[model samples]
Target: MNNDTDTARLRKLDQDHHLHPFTNLSRHSQQGGRIISRAEHIYIYDSDGNKMLDGMSGLWCCNLGYSQTLIKDAIYAQLQALPYYNNFFQCANEPAVELARALVEITPAQFSHVFFTNSGSEANDTNIRLVHRYYNLLGKPKKTLIISRKNAYHGSTIAATSLGGMGAMRKQTQGLDYVHHINQPYWFAEGADELPDEYGIRVARELEQKIDELGEDRVAAFIAEPVQGAGGVIVPPQSYWPEIKRICNERDILLIMDEVICGFGRTGNWFGSQSYNLEPDLMTFAKAVTNGYIPLGGVMVGDRVAEVLLSHSGEFAHGMTYSGHPAACAAGIATLSVLRERNIIKSAADDIAPYFQQRLQTLKDHPIVGEVRGIGMLGAVELVRDKHSRERLAPDAAGAVYCRDRANATGLMVRQSGDTMITAPPLICNHSEIDSLVNMLSKTLDQTAEHFNIR
Candidate 1:
C-alpha cells in the first residue's frame, strides 16, 4: 500500500485502540483524525497536503520551530556514536555534563547544579523526591507538602499531577492528596474589583496563610509557573512574584519554578524566573530545552538545596533509564546553539512579539472578547458569555469548541484551554507570520461569535 493509505489505515486503527490525553474519547472516535505528514518553519502539513499555521507551536514546545538541520544532524551523529547510555552510579556521558555546564551559564545565577530527566513531568516528579529527601536529610521529616497555585500545570505524571493546579487534571486522580492549593494571581478573574497591587498582595498572602495552616515545618516548597501556561496563560502582576519570593525566603521554603512552557526565550528571556524576577531555589525545565525535537527535561538546583540533598544521602533515590540519554543531550546542545546563533529569542521579543502582542490586544475591542492577555510569544483570548459580567463561557458546548474549530478552518492551529484560546507561535516566527496569525485569530473570533449567536 502507498504511504497515504498506510497512514489513513493507521489513523483508523488508532481511533479504535488509542486513548488521547486532554480530549473527549467519545468525540475523538466520532471525528476521526488528521495525520500530520511534515512540518517546516511555523506550518504543519497534514497527510492531505493542507498547511496550517501552528499558532500554538505544537503545544508550546517547538519554540525554535520545525526542521532545524542543526538539531537533526546532532541527533544523527549521536545515534551513530552511541544510541544509549544510562546515567547510573559513576557512569555518565560527556554530552550530559557539557549540557549541564552550558545550562548553568544561562539560568539564573543561583542555579548551580543540574539533574536530568526524560520529560518535564519526570523532572517535576524528581523535584518532589529530591525536596522530600533534602528535608529528610536535614532531619526535618515532617516537611512533605508542596504548595502550588490553583490553575498551575507542572505535568501529567502522578507526582507532577499532584503538584499541578488544573482542576480537570486533579479530578482524574480522585482522593489524591498531599499537595496544597493556593489562589492563582490571575488579576483578570480574581482581581476584578481590587487594585492590581492589592489583588496581587491578596493572592501572595494566601501562600503565607497556607504555610501557617500547614505549619512552616510541614511545607517543603512552593512550586508554580512564572506564567501559568496550560492554566490559561495567566500572567501575574509585578507585585506577585516579589511577594512570593519574599514569603518563600522568610518561610525557608524552596521556591520551585516550573518553566516547562515559559523557558528558553519563550518569555523574552533565557528563563521565566528572569522575566518575572522570581528567585527560585529550584527549577523544572523542559519542552523548549530540546525544542521538542527530543524527549529531554531537567531540574536545576541552587547550592543550598543541592548541599542538603547530598548531605542527606550519598546517592539520589530516583532516576529514569533514559535520563541524560546521549542523543537527546546532543539535540539539546544543538538547539541551544541555534537559539543563540540565530538570535531568535531577541528578534521575537524586540520586533515580532511586540507587534503580535499589540495586534492581539486589538481583539479586546471586539464585543465577544472578555480579555486579551499574554507576554512574549504566549497570548490568550478569553471568551465570556457576558463581557461586562465577566462570566466564564461554559466549557461544554458553550466554549472552546466554536473558537478552536473556527480557527482551524481558517488555517490557524490554536488550542483551547477551557474558555481561553491560547496562542504561542514559535520564537522563529517572522513579522508577516505574526500578522497572519493575528488576522486569522480575528476571523476565528468573529466566526465564533456568530456561531454562538452573540452580537
Candidate 2:
C-alpha cells in the first residue's frame, strides 16, 4: 500500500481487467477509484494511505465490523476440516445443518425450515420456485402473479429483478411478466398533502387493489423489504405493516419479506420483520448473516409453506450447486453466536442506535438537509435547496453525488441513493465513533452547500 510503484501497477491492472458491479464502466476505466489496502475495526485504508471510516459498513454487511476474528477463524477451521461439499444427493455438511437450526431458533416461530443459496438474489429467485411448487401441490396453479412495491430493492437476477420494482434495474433485465408493483411508503417524497399514517393505509390498500385488478385467484405472493434499503433507507410509517398484514390475512396470498439489509440486528431485532411485527411466509436474508465474511443467503420458510413443501413427496427440482457451502455456513454460525451471546441487537438498540439517530438528527437544521429519517442503525438525509417546498438542489441527483464525493474526500465512506445520503454504519460503533461520523458528515454538508450556492 505504501509503495507508489506497486499502487500504480495495481491501479492499471484493475482499470484494465476488473468489471465492477453497479459502476459506470467507462468512467471507472478513465478515472479509476481508490484501491483499498486493508481495514480494521470500522476504518479502511487505501493504497494512497488515506484512512476512511466505513460509514456504509462494507455495503451494509459487516455489522460487527472488520475485526471479528471469530467468524474468520470459523471459516478457516471449516475449510480445513471439510474443504468443499455440496448439499446435494442426500448430502449435508455439519456446519450447514447447524446453521439451519440456528436460523430457525433466531427467526420467528413460523420459520421452522430454511432453503439455502449463495446470495439474496438467488434466495429470492428460490422463493418464486417454492411458491409455485407449494401452490401447485395445493392445486392452485393459477397463482403466479407476485406484487412488490415501487422503488424497493430485492436483488439483481432476472427473477429477483422482476420481484424488485426499481424501474432502472428492470429496464435492463427484462423482468418477468407475472410480477407487479405498487406504491412504496416513502412519505417524504411520495406522501404529498396527507399525514404519514394516512399515506401508509392508502398505499397498503394498493396491494388489495392490485390483487383484485389482477384477479385474486392469480395472485401468488407479496414481497418487500422491511425498509427500502438500496432504494434509499425509506422506513414505512407505523400503520403500514398492520395494514399490509391485514390484507395478506384476508386474501389468499403469501408474504415474503426481503431482509437482505435489515436482517442480523440492523433494525434492533434478529430480523426487521420482528421489529415491524409481521410474520412473512418466507424471509430472504443475506449480507450480515455471515457478517459479510463469506457469501451465504437463504429463505426462512414459514410453517405454512414448509408444511406443504414437506408433505409433498417429490424433488423440489431447484437448488444451487453450492446451496449450503460449509465454509459460508460456518461463518454464519459464528456470526449468529456473536449476535446472540453478546446480545448485540438489544445492546445497540438501547444505546448506540439511539445516539446514532440523535447525532444524525442534528443535521436537520443544515441549509441543504431537508429531512432526517432513520431506524436502528440505518439512516438517510434528503438534500434540498428549499426545505419547505422540497426543491432539489440539482437535477439528476447531482447534489447527492456531490455530497457523497465530499464525504469520501473527508475520509468517510458513504453513498448516494437517489437524492439522499444513505448510511448503514456498523452496529458496533460507540458514541465517540458516531460523533466522528456525524462531524465528517456535517463538514461534507457545509462543503456541499457552498458548492451548490444553497445558503
Candidate 3:
C-alpha cells in the first residue's frame, strides 16, 4: 500500500471535486468513500491501508486480477512506439488492427468484423446506429425499434441508457421512443411460485408478445445480457435462452447480446453468447477486453450484419475520437494473450468456477437467503424476510444495503442490486481464496440476520 497517501486530505479533495457515477452525490460528499490506493491479485488496499478481497472483480471487469504486468508493459511499449493515432482518413495503427483480428478469432465464427469504441456505453450507442444503418441499407428504415428486458443495464450514456430497461436510469432522462422493454426472466423475484423451467418459458415468450405487438417488421432487434449481471446476476432458467433464440429466429428479429459484463470468460466461456448457445447478430464487448487496465470496447459484428454494412456504398457516419486507441488496443492484445497463454479462462471454467459455485450454494440454507443462483464465476443471494413465502424485507433493498456494508466492513467487496447480493470474483482466485470469500460473506450474512432478529 502507498504509505505516503494522506487519507484524510485525499478524502477531502475527493469530496470537493470528484463527482462519482451512480452515487448519491450529497451523501457521498458528506460521508466520503474508500479511496482505493493499490491492488494486487484479487485484493485492493484503501488509502487507510485496509485490504479487502474484491469479490465484484473491480466492477465486473478485472478478470485477470490486478497484478498482470503484461498488460501494463504492453501499453508502455505501444506508447513508446506510437503515442497516438487516428483510425480515420484511411489511416490505421498496428495495435488497433491486430486487436481487431484477435477479437474476431476468439469470438464465435459468425463474428468476422469489429468496430471499436472507448467504453461499453459508446459500444452500445454504436450498436443502435449500426442496427439502424444496416436496416436502412437493406431498405427497411421503419425497423428501428429495439426490445430489451426490464431491469437490464446496458450503459449510462444517453443512447445506451435508452436501450436499457432500468427504471431509475430511464427516469433520469427521457428515453428514445424506438426502444421498448419486456419482462425479465428474473425467476426468484417474478416467478417464485412456478417451476423455474416453466417460468423461464413464460417470460421468454414475452419477447414474442412484444414483437407481435410492435409488428415484426417494425422491430429492428432484441438486445439482452446472456446473464443479467447488473440486474443482480439473474441467471435465467435452462429453458430461457433456447426459447428466446427460437423466437428471434422464427420472427426474423435480430438478436444483440450485450456482452459488456459477461464477455471475456465471466460466464466460463469466451463470451456469454457461447455459454447459452446464443447466436446474436452483434455483441457489445468491454470491461475485460483489456482487464479494465485500459478503456477499450467494441461491437463484434456477425456475418449477417457485417455483410450488409460492408456492402453499403457510403460511410456509416458514427465513431469516437478515441475509437481503437493504440495503447488501449495493445492492452487488449496483452490481456487476451495472458488469458489464452495461462489458460486462465479454461481453468476458471473447468476448475475454479465449480468450486466457486459450490461455495456460493452453501449460503442457500441461510435464513435470509431465499434463493442462491449462479453460473460460472457470477452469483447472487436473494435476501427475503420469509424464505418460504419469498417475502421481501420492508423498505425495499434496505436489507441488501445493510448486508453489503457489513461485507465491506469485513474486508469483502460485494454489490447489492435491490434485495440481491451479487459477486463476481477474479478468475485467478484459488481454493483458499474462494473459502475466504465465502466465509467472509457467511459472516456478513449471519450478522445481518442477527440485526434483523432472524435465525
Candidate 4:
C-alpha cells in the first residue's frame, strides 16, 4: 500500500465507510483526506511519501515523539506477560497498580489516588460521577451544578461535552442541565477595552459570581484547562489562577483542572496545574500519559476528594471495562520512566520550550498576525484583518481553515481553532525541528496573507 494506486484505494475505502470526528462530511467525501501512512520522531509521512513536521504533535499527545522503542517494547512485553485483565470485582493488574503509583509520585503530593479510564472523555465523565457521589455522601445532594468556562475543551462524550463550554458542541443537543458556563480568559478575542490582567481577573471573578448566583450550596465543582488548548492556547494573565483558587476555596467549590492536553510534561511540569501553581481537588488527564501509544486516562484524585470517597462505605458504582487495562498501563509506566530518566520534561521546559516559544513569538510581527501567545510546547497565532482592531480575517473562521490547509501543504501539521492557528510540538523536538516547524508555519501565514490580499 505504498504506491499512489493503493493510497487511492485506501482513501476510497475510508470515504465510503469511515465517519470521522469534527470533519465536514460533504467536503471530505468529495475531496478525500490525506492518508498518513507512517510517522517517525516529530514527522509524519503521507501515503505518497511526503514528509511533514508534526507541529501539533498528533493532536497534542505524542510528547515523546513517534518512534519511542521503550513504550512499544513495554506494550509488547505486557502483552506477553498479562495481555488482558479486569480491574473490576476487586481485581487489579500489576501494570495498572504500578502505573497508578507512578502517576501519584509524579503529580502533586495531594494526589495519592487514581481512577483510570480509556480516554479523557471517560475521565471527565468519571469526574461528574465522583463529584456528585462525593456531595451525596456528604448529604449535600443539592450541590450538583458544575461551572465551566466558554470555549474550553474537556472531551466529546455526552457528559464531558456538557461539562465543556463550546457552544457549537452544545447546539446539536441539550447539555446536562446542572452544568453552566462563564466567559473564557481569551484576552485577545474578548478583552476589548480592558488590559489583559484586568480582563483575566474579571473573567476569573465570573466563577465566584456564578457560585454566588447558584447559592454556593448548589455548585459542586468548577472545571477548566490550565491553558485552553483547543480554545487556541489562551494563556490567562498571571492574576487569573490565584483569583480562581481563592474563589473556589472561599466558596467551597471543588476545582477540577482538565489536564487532558497539558498533562504529562506538555507544559514543562508533569502537570499543567503544577505549571500554573494550581492545586485542584481533581485533575482529568490523558493523551501523553502513554505518549499516545495506547489509550489511558484517569483522574488524579486529590486528598480532599479521595478521603471523602474512601471514607464512604458504599461502592462508587462508576467505572469502565477498560479502566485499568494492563497493556495501556504498561505503556504508561514505560512512558513515565522514559520521561523521568531522560529528563525530557525538564529539558523541554528549560531548553526546547524557550526556543519554540521564541520562534512562535516572531510571528507576531507578521502583517496578518494579530497576536502570538504560548508557553512551554504549546502556542497559537491569531490571524486578523486589522491587527490593531483585532478584526477577524473571516467571520466563519474560514481564514484559519485555509491557513491550516496551507500549512499542511507546506509540510507542517498545525491546528486551527476558530481564527487562531495553534501548535503543540512533541517535547522531543530539537532546535532544528522547532525551526522547521516555525518556518513552515511562517510560510503558511505568508501564503494565507497573500491569498486574502492582505498588504
Off by over 4 Å in 1: 1-7, 393-397
**Against the true structure, what is each candidate's TM-score?**
0.96, 0.99, 0.99, 0.99
Cα lDDT over the full model 3: 0.93
Error of 2 at 255 (Å): 0.5
CA lDDT, every model vs. true structure: 0.87, 0.94, 0.93, 0.92
Ranking by lDDT: 2, 3, 4, 1
Off by over 4 Å in 4: none
lDDT string for model 1 (35-68, tens) is 7878998899877777899998898899988979
TM-score, predicted candidate 3 vs. hidden true structure: 0.99
Model 3 lDDT per residue over 239-319, tens place: 999999999989877899999999999999999999999899999999999999999999999999999988879988988
User: Candidate order by TM-score, highest to lowest?
Assistant: 2, 4, 3, 1
Where is the poorest 10-residue window by lDDT in model 1?
392-401
> In angstroms, how far off is 92's CA in candidate 3?
0.5
Residue-wise lDDT of candidate 2 within 1-455, one digit each (tens)? Answer: 87999899999999999999999999999898889999999999999899999999998999999999999999999989997899989999999999999999999999899999999999999999999998999999999999998898888999998999888888897789999999999999989689999999999999999999999999999999999999999999999999999999999999999999999999999899999999999999999999999999999999999999899898989999989999999999999999999899999999999999999999999999999999999999999999999999999999999999999999999999989999999999999999999999999999999999878
Off-target runs (Cα >4 Å) in candidate 2 are none
Expressed as tens digits, the lDDT of each residue in 1-455 for candidate 4 is 36979999999999988889989998888889989999998889999999988988898899989999999999999999999989999999999999999998998988999999999999999999999998999999999999998998899999989988888998976889999999999888888789878888998999888988998889999999999999889999988999998888788789999999999888889889998888899999999999998999999999999999999898899888889999999999999999999999998999999999999988999999999989899999999999888998987999999999999889888999999999999999889988888988999999999999998
- Residue 336 accuracy (lDDT) in model 4: 93
Give model 2's clash tally: 0
